[model samples]
Structure formats: C-alpha cells, structure tokens
Target: MYCLNVLFASQLNHKSILKLIRCCLETQIPILVFESIEYETLADRNHRPSHPCFKPLLFTNRLKIAVEIANAIAYLHFRFAKPILFRIIKPWNILIDKQNIVKLFDFSLSVSIPKGETHIKDVGRGTMGFVAPEYVTTRGCFNEKCDVFCFDVLLFVLLTGQEITDYLRCEKGNKFYLVYDVKKYFVNNRVK
Candidate 1:
C-alpha cells in the first residue's frame, strides 16, 4: 500500500464536467471519489436503432448535448493559461445527467500543452474508430486538433449510433487496427 501526504486538486468548476470529491491511493489500485449524479454514459444510450431497448432522443436534444460537450472541450483547450487535452474523448467518457446535461470525464490520457510547443507526441491512446490518423502515422505527434478529430467522430456516432463508414478494422490481440489506406488521406485534411 502507498500513502500520500499531499493531495492533488484540480481547479475545474465547470457544469459540464464531473467533480472529483477525493482521491485515495492507500491500496494497490487508486480509488477516486466523485460527486454522484443521476446519469448514464453516452455509450449506453447510443445503442443500435434496431435494438428493442433503443429509445430515440430528440434531434434538438442531441444537438444541445453536442454543443454542451463542444463548449466544455473548448473551455479546456483555450480558457486556461495552459491548454489541457482530453485525449480519450469518447462516448463512454461522456455522461448524460437526468436533466439532460452533458458531463465530460476521464482524464487518464489527457495532458497539458507545454508553453512554446505547438505539438506533442503521445502514445496513440485513443479509441479505434475515432483516433486521428495523423496522430498515429506521425508516431503520436499531434495537437489540439486531435481532439477536434475525436469530436467529429463522436458527433457522427451521436447522430448515427454506429461507427463511421470507409474505415476497415481487424482485431489483433483484442486491439482493433484500421486497414484502409490511412496514409493516402493524410496528405489532405480528410483523415486528420
């Protein structure tokens, strides 16, 4: 077991973000305590249209949720002194509260953009269908636009509740890999 005399506190007071109550690392696995909210993950809501449990959300509500998430991401990227990157912005990371409010969470893969640096190299630690091609092909060199790329894919998923077309993927060691000519579109803004 590990003990910490100091606690790291985040200064985010946004409505569309989860509030961390406390963090405990006394045991082998660190446990995080968060303020409870009446909500479910976006992934659970974005089920197949043909599924019996599928319940359609109003287009207006969907748009509103998207806007809320976009606003939160924009705030994280631009409002602070140093921009923070939510590297794993996926449906599972977003929660829809009972009041239909969107809350973004899960910052395990996030980082802050160092001053004077336009891009940062990462470990390609994003979802299979939504990762920016440039981030992977360039060996993880990416900027905030990678979040935009992820947001775009999330938008499509929110609208269609399915993976975007034209990208082929196969599972290797339980990890999915895109098999399309991901490099061909890298020249243009098509795959970025």
Candidate 2:
C-alpha cells in the first residue's frame, strides 16, 4: 500500500507532485492511495540495469530529472507554512516514472520543524557522502542546509558517474577532500 503522511498529503496539489486518490485512517495502519506511477528507483537502475546493453540516458533527461528534484526540494523546504527538511536526498531515493517524471521518495528520514523551532537536535540519521559536513564535524549538529549540500553532491554524481571515493582518488596527491576539490580545481585547474 502506498503510504503518505498527512504533512505531505497536503502538498499533493502541485502538478509535478503526485495526487492522493484517497486516504484510509480506519485501521491501525494509515495508508494513502496515490496515482500509480509506473517507474523504477534510480538506485535500482544504476545498480542492476534492466538491460545488459543499457543505453545511456540523454543529457537532457538527466538535467530534467535534476531540475525536478531541485524543484521538489525547494517546495518542501519553503512552499508550506511550516518548512519540512528532507534529510535524505539521494539518487537511489529518487523514482523515475515511465514518463520520465521524478518523484522523490523515502521521506522516512525527513523531519518537520515546529513552526517556531529553529534547531532540533540532530540524530545523525543520514547516508554517507550525501550527509552534510556539519552533521559530521559538529557531531550531528546541522540543519536544512545539509540537504542543500547533499543536492550539490547529487548533481555532481549525476553529471560524472563517479562516486565520492572515485572522485577523490582521481586527485593527484589526494590531500583535498570532496567538498574542497571543486575550489581546488578552480584555483589550479586540478584536483590536488
């Protein structure tokens, strides 16, 4: 059964967003019916390509999906009266429908800050590489900004099919980290 929390169900009005067909709050479990999306998770597509000779995704399609993801994140972070933090934003967590529409799923890691609350204690519930540095350096102290950082990493991964480790290994000396690599590249036109 499709599951959608009340918080997200309210935002289903957006066109790019999925629509809720009905809600079932009767039994112990809560279930919300949404329009069925014929799709596969981006992670699955990457991990085990359905076809042996997988055709490369068009640059345009990748860009479109990236834009859709950004829009969805923007909406989630600011569109509502109360902002929502999508703690986990990664390609595997994204769904690509048959029509090539992107649907960001797996909101289990998401949290809703009370209208006036500024900083809630971080539980360090996030994936590696995609997680923000503040969540690491500060010992689980971070905010929505973490999502923005993750998005940047997501964009990089999408453009270059390279994992964070792979990118780091490509550096000559490997003294610079993932986040600093871009700046290093701009400064010396190389990763050091």
The Cα error of candidate 1 at residue 141, in Å, is 0.9
Please give, for residues 4-36, the per-residue lDDT of candidate 2 as tens digits: 355565464555555667667786876767778
* Global lDDT of model 2: 0.68
In candidate 1 the C-alpha lDDT for residue 151 amounts to 89
Candidate 1's residue-wise lDDT over 67-145, tens digit each? Answer: 9999988988987777777877788899886567888987777777779998878774777777887888889887889
- Report the C-alpha displacement of residue 74, candidate 1, in angstroms: 0.4
Over 4 Å off, model 1: 1-9, 48-54, 164-192
lDDT of each: 0.71, 0.68
In lDDT terms, which candidate is top? 1
Question: What is the lDDT for 115 in model 2?
Answer: 73
True lDDT of residue 111, candidate 2: 67
